[model samples]
Target: MTVATFDTAVIGGGLVGCWTALFLARRGARVAILEKGSVGAQSSGTNFGNLRLQGRFPGQYPLSLRSQAIWEQLQDFVGSACEYERTGHLYCAFDEGEAEKLEGYAKVSESYGLSIERLGREDLKHRYPWLADKVTAATFSARDATANPRLVTPAVARAARDAGASVFENIRVSEVRKSGSGFELRADPDLRIHCANVVNAAGAWAVEIAEQFGETAPLFAAGPPQFVTEPFPYFMSPSVQTIDGSVIVRQTRRGNLILAGYPRTAADPASQRVPVPPQKTLAAMKRLAELAPVLRSCSVIRVWSGTEGYLPDMVPVIGASETTPGLWHAFGFCGHGFQIGPGVGLCLSEMILDGGTETPLEPFGIGRFRSGVAVSEKFRREFDERKTA
Candidate 1:
């Protein structure tokens, strides 16, 4: 066979990789995507589809904002239906302390241009009569919404293909090495792909790809358990979250109630399979019952799990590699990449094509992990200080 050379090679065909390839190909660069499976077959298609802005880490606020804006105009770019729904989002609190924290967060969020409204106990009960009586307060971000996870990545891949990008499905990259002028990717059997630059958006298997270039990050597999109930009356509209990060509940357009909030199971990134624990499902169902008593009559019809990468700092690693030139990394999204997938792609495309991005990529560099201070330790210390504050 002949050599396949491209200006850029993307190592994943998920939503992020597809968007990155779309932007690069649109910019007149030769781009090809290598996917171990069909596009959005794994985490991208299996997530709860929350395009939320509330309760996110402060560092992710800007990216979430940008991604939300892109999501609002998704069809304009992808030229396909993503099943996007602007159902708003609500974070409920069960106690006064939790409510106070939410009130404080709402105030802080306003400075960032996020108009989150805090509802007191009476106000929340009056607006959402279905909520559990234990709910003391809630905060609502009207711009937050949900979409069809199953449709997003495929739509993006189709858009990228229309923009002159090639997507190779079920072709796994066994190994990658720096060649004389670029990188050579060794694939199944006799396939070899040469590219000037590679973007490691390999989803759950991102760490392995980054390691080939001498870049190391602390990423672990976290599989959030999810289940869907039989179609019922569409009572709930907005996606709902708890202030303590326990249970997330949402009702789809088809009236199927989808939820996730239990102990995560170990995930195998290589296989991209995560089995939901039976006990965890029961526990999550119990919690859901407490949050919304009306769910007691709803029977869960199906349960599933998706493999997601979780970094120690709970942040993503984006931008150029520190050790290897002509290499870039954009992975380790820590279970929240779904909301910011498009923004990450746009920023990375800008960095690769324009030498810099409007979005700040310094905070997500791999150098942060190289520092003597471990992210887990820093996070623990910060949490302790916050408790005192």
Candidate 2:
């Protein structure tokens, strides 16, 4: 059968994949996205929609800054309502030790040009009295924001399609191998595609595609439990987090409180499915009540979970393939890729079409795990065991 060809074929139609295709097509490169399921039906759609710049790893701060700027201008290009809001992020510390840590992080983050304002108890009470009295110290970053997670990826996919990228949904790639100076992909019985370059943006399943190309890392599926409360009078302003890393709390414009915490559920690798255990939600609610007494009276309306790729160090693989030429990877953002999704796609597009990116991608290289040629079995086994357990 004659194979349809393009300049690039992006596997996995998550936010990264769709944005990559959109940027590539805008640059006049023929691009196609092959998705196994519906666009944004997985992690990207289910995340808490936090566009935060606070509490980011040092290496990720630069990329997140660029992403935040893009998110502000993104609606003009995507042509859809993202429900974007610059709600800011307030991280509260319940005690002296947590306050010290928050202060340290603020000092370091400020070195990177991030504006972090440390707030003492009196400052917090004066600015945000809605918070519980236990919050003795806090840090605020006003530029951090939120958006509608359900609307982002699909809007990007539609914009990519409108920009001349072929998007084939529900086409699971059965096999992918190097072809003559390019790569070939077989989706099913009769569908085949050949492209000069391939991108593995398959979210949690990216490990399998990376393995097929002789590259691997300690990536495992991790699920974060999320819940929303019934709509009430919106009292909370800025999105809140604990310096102790206990929980994240935010209130939507319509007055629903959203929460996520450390109580994790397992995600199945084979099916890429994460089950939301009711017990974890209960535990999260209990912790929330402890943090903010007002939440004790709130009624939960829904609970859910999203499967994200978690590397051992919690960073993602976001560079060219170490083994295969013309192949690239842009997955494994841990559970936080939603915020930097657009910036990552632009970086990958620049790397592919322009030979390099202005954004420093050195820290995200696949070779960090080992040599630039193959997977390290030792790292793989450790992460696999931890994931399964």
Candidate 3:
């Protein structure tokens, strides 16, 4: 079969891949997104729809803040009504220690012009009457918001198509290679195609694919299973997290609660399909009971799991591929990619079409790990702590 040629070939149809394709095509690059499954079928679809700015590492705060800004203007960018709102996100601290952590995070995040207020007992009760009695204080970051992952991913893919990009679903990118000035990508169990550039946005699978072309990074994954309660009322949650790390509940605009914490299965290298075990559901519900007693017995009609990619340092490698000349990466986001996905995509696209990103992709370059490359002292100190954390 004769293969198609394009300016760029994106190797994953998850959120990152779709965004890369959409923006590249918008910039006049003929693009094709090859998805092993349906768009967002992987962790992209499974992720809890929380577009948050709280609990973010200080370095990532700025980039994430920009992405969150774009999220506010997503409707204007996509020219479609995206289900998103910045109703606010809160981090619940059941004790003094938890509250203390919030204080440190607040001071660190202040440079980004982000506001994080510590909530007292009365403040907690006044804001969310459903808050559990155990909740002593909460940190509120009203700048954060959420969007329906299911709705957003497909909408992005559709917008990409409308803007002149092709999306091929159920086609796995079997192999990738550097061919002269471009990239040669083989899909399906093996269908060869070529493009001027390739974007490795395969989420969890990104590590292995980059390895295939002799470009590897320390990317690990763990699947976290969660359950959601049926619609109750339009209750705003601001994102919720516990000192015990037991549960996090964010009420959707539709009144349903997106719950997490106490995921059933651990990260399994064998299977991405995670089963929400009864134990996990019970744990989530119990925590919900402790946090929002009113939702303790809130019947849950749906349970699912999502696998998140993690780098050894817990940050994303958002710019380039070392071994391949015309390749780049926008993966290993752990759980924070959604908030940073768009801005990363825009910056990464510029780097690919040109040579560098104005947003400082230098710290994120894959070349840092080359055998002869020395680790940056600052990067070393930072990563060492993340490893310990």
Candidate 4:
């Protein structure tokens, strides 16, 4: 019979939402995170765990760099490393065209003050002898890192809770509407949450809340099919990916090889089911073997996918809401949410408390959808546009 009140109500418990709650609570604001399921049970936990700095959208460099700093000092920030490592990221190319693309990416990254090492064919072979002979060139960024996706969200949520934020799991928020000067969230199990501000970081299901506030984006649900092989020798250090977006493979300390690929599999957000097609798995396996001949005989033990929202422009919507006051949106990250999750959270907290952030988030404003979304070059090459709807 009693209603809960808070300074901010964060809808979704993934990395972004949890981190937002953590920072807000740490700043002495009352915060609550409403998650439909357990924390980190969605795309935040199922992603490839890549903290790649190269080949990112040029505009995202600021936030990415800020986030990488948080990840580097994760233990001091969240009290958990989450199996993080800065073992570096190697982007390889199989032909001249892809090789040229790698160079362009490296230049972009270098312009942003990130150190990038361009490697010729011989340099790659000399450094990584296990690489296939057909590889022509590569770009290595020692700053690009990775972490255990499975461990991060839960840890961050726990930190948020430790900082005095209330985390409510299995509470599906059905509606959020302006109530008086603030907003009220209606959820399952007869729960009502009143807060001065609301944050829509709901991952794949975020659009529903946005639409209610007279905002809409061309968001579609999809997931990159992922596979993990049985334990092998822990030789591979840095995470590796092909410039063509064929496959990305990394060897964990436990010796399991994790692989993910593009042309992502379509997912049903209504059912919360992301099924990995068997053919996609086979294709990823073949590409993985071609990347490293030594892993040709590795046995895949599992395959999976997670629901993630992708916008036509391949950038997220992060900023205050246009049609409604006291509301903010941070969703539709495509597949890059994991690495920048913390920085986005920090920016959101700043915007909510200090009235703005210095992160230059103008490019990702939700208002861009009204002017006609300009498809990014990466969106065209990374996904099958026909399936975006």
Per-prediction TM-score, please? Answer: 0.94, 0.94, 0.90, 0.98
Tens-place lDDT per residue, model 3, 189-293, is 557788888888888888878887777776666655667888987765577877444677788767888887743254554566656667778777877887888
TM-score winner between 2 and 3, please give it.
Answer: 2
List ranges where model 2 is wrong by over 4 Å.
371-389
Q: Write the per-residue lDDT of candidate 1 for residues 88-139, one digit (tens) a residue.
A: 9999999889888888788767768998887887897788888899998899
- Range of the 10 consecutive residues with the lowest summed lDDT in candidate 1: 380-389
Candidate 3 has its poorest 10 consecutive residues by lDDT at 380-389
Report lDDT (Cα) of residue 388, candidate 4. Answer: 24
The 0-to-1 C-alpha lDDT of every candidate, in the order given, reads 0.84, 0.85, 0.76, 0.92
Residue range 170-286, candidate 4, lDDT tens digits: 999999999999999999989999999999999989989999999989888888788999999999999999987788999999999999987788889989989987888888889
Give one digit per residue, the lDDT tens place, for model 2 in 1-389: 54799999999999999999999999999999999889998889988888888877788888888888889987886997588889999988888988888888888789889899888889987988777798899999999898888999999999999999999998889888998999999986478998999999998888788898898887778777789999978888888888654588889889999898763567886787788877777778888888788778888999887778877667789999988989999887877799999999999999999999899888899888884424334224435455233
User: Where does model 1 exceed 4 Å of error?
Assistant: 372-389
lDDT of 3: 0.76
Question: Which 10-residue window of candidate 2 scores lowest in summed lDDT?
Answer: 373-382
Error of 1 at 338 (Å): 0.5
Which pairs clash inside model 2? none
